[model samples]
Target: MQNDLFPTDAESERLRYEPFHESVEILDLYEHHRSGEMDVVMRPLGENPHATPKATMDELQSAKEAWESGERATYTISSKSDGEFVGVAEQWLEWDKRRASFGMWIREPFWGRGCSSERAGTMSYVAFEWLDLDLVSVGHDPENEQSRRAIEKYVDAYCGQHDAVLRNWLPSNDFGDPTGVHVYSILQEQWRENVTTAEIATIRVGA
Candidate 1:
């Protein structure tokens, strides 16, 4: 099912992001998932802390299927400089409302390097410019101050509004139990007004 609501590929000055496909190296993804540094990221998704090689392969396959089925837009983030796997970014589409929610987890090595903001800017470009969506939303576990800070920076840059904290909105632990999430959203109009042409130029959507 090809969905016009998602972009096949996109990139920024520092990162290249695209749907899961054959070129993605499973071993690399598995190594990253199995690393102790990724425990924090995995916990929020209720993923296995001790992810086996098979588990990583299965998850990558699942993401590829989801993208093909138009159920989600999942991108593997990589460095443009050396093509190193940086992390993953995803967008959950709500076609009826012309809205999509963003989610991402970066490798610990890439943290504090503006990768999150760059990825957000590129995805927002896809949502508004390519997908023609009305709004792009993102939320993070309340206790995740790192994510909170990263999200807030781009949300503010896009002239987005901070929505309320929705209680029990996300999985917080390995148990899959729910937790509160701080939500934010950027409307198409707001994106049009705040994201400059130069900034938009930095994101190449058809990459």
Candidate 2:
């Protein structure tokens, strides 16, 4: 019964390629390289008290480098959101050719604006068209309904489908509902008819 609702890549839809980027400011108000007044940028996907800006900045710098090159990884979320850093999103390529996985995080102040879908659509499009990739994947916990909806929109835009549900995927990880991991993905050649109508638009300060 559940299998029918959630299908594999072969039974699901794919997406056409597109280009995309998510932007953010370099600093928060205190002249710090952060994105919030509460000093919350470097925490895990869920909330935590021990987050530090110094650690996040270090990781983010490395993430930027990894993204610039066609490496085996993307970004891990290091964010605090009062619309200062605008949040983070990154994709990666692997040597195994299994599937490219993407992750996205928006500042709390700017989460509902629908940037998630737009970024995902554009990135999915790019991965399929330019990168010559096979599949794209994304995941979230069951307790995070907002994140779940965002992932749904992204996959919907890219015409992606359900992957495996990694039950109790990361019990040790701090992210809530580790047992309820939900994965979604799609392949190339499924962008016909525009299932991706993401409304979020990207704007550059100088360009």
Candidate 3:
């Protein structure tokens, strides 16, 4: 439901990342999920807001289940200085396609600070290198320019077709706005070509 990061800051206080674990604070995630900024970023064209703490916790638990089931991979984005839950990144795999679709969302306070872009880079590395997946796909809503720009920052790394638009691809919300989704993808061969200069370093995920 969220998107991209800034790569200039390599310091720990600026950002650090780890795979989502049971130790992550559910409340912190709940707050991010319910914030007005997240609502707008994730649901500007839609309206299924998680209005309660219980619902937020349930959603987190469900995500954990999905991760454990090997259906997807999820990571917690945090600040090293305080280890705060600033965001999350995920790769939802489509086994049939041998592709993983990356998704991420940063806390409202962390927006514009490059958290999303960092996570995006990490997601690509893990999918293309660690997982040895065939392809990586990412997309954003047609009207979400912020998301568009964030995702576009990685264009050189993937360089797939930019004109692939799916009409009404996403379900309409109460507002019934344009649901066309723009998709970008990179083949495994392309990733291999870009890995040398992609600045990819593996983010360890423990069993």
lDDT ranking from best candidate downward = 1, 3, 2
What's model 3's TM-score? 0.80
Residue 155 of model 1: what lDDT?
93
What stretches of model 1 exceed 4 Å from their correct place?
1-5, 44-46, 171-173
Report the CA-based lDDT of candidate 3 relative to the real structure: 0.67
* Comparison by TM-score, 1 against 2, better one: 1
Model 3 misplaced stretches (Cα beyond 4 Å):
1-14, 33-37, 45-48, 174-178, 196-198, 201-207
For candidate 1, which ten residues in a row score worst on lDDT?
A: 42-51
Q: Give the per-residue Cα lDDT of candidate 2 at 168.
A: 74
Per residue, candidate 2 scores C-alpha lDDT tens digits across 1-207 of: 111211111100121111121132223312433334333433435444234655545555565555455453332122223213444456766647746787765556656776677557655654664466777888886667787888887677656687777877766444444455788878765653444333212211110
RMSD of each: 2.0, 10.5, 5.8
TM-score, candidate 2, is 0.63
Q: Rate the local accuracy (lDDT) of all candidates.
A: 0.82, 0.51, 0.67
* Cα-based TM-score, every candidate: 0.91, 0.63, 0.80
How should the candidates be ordered by TM-score, best one leading?
Answer: 1, 3, 2
Displacement of residue 37 (Cα, Å) in model 3 is 4.7
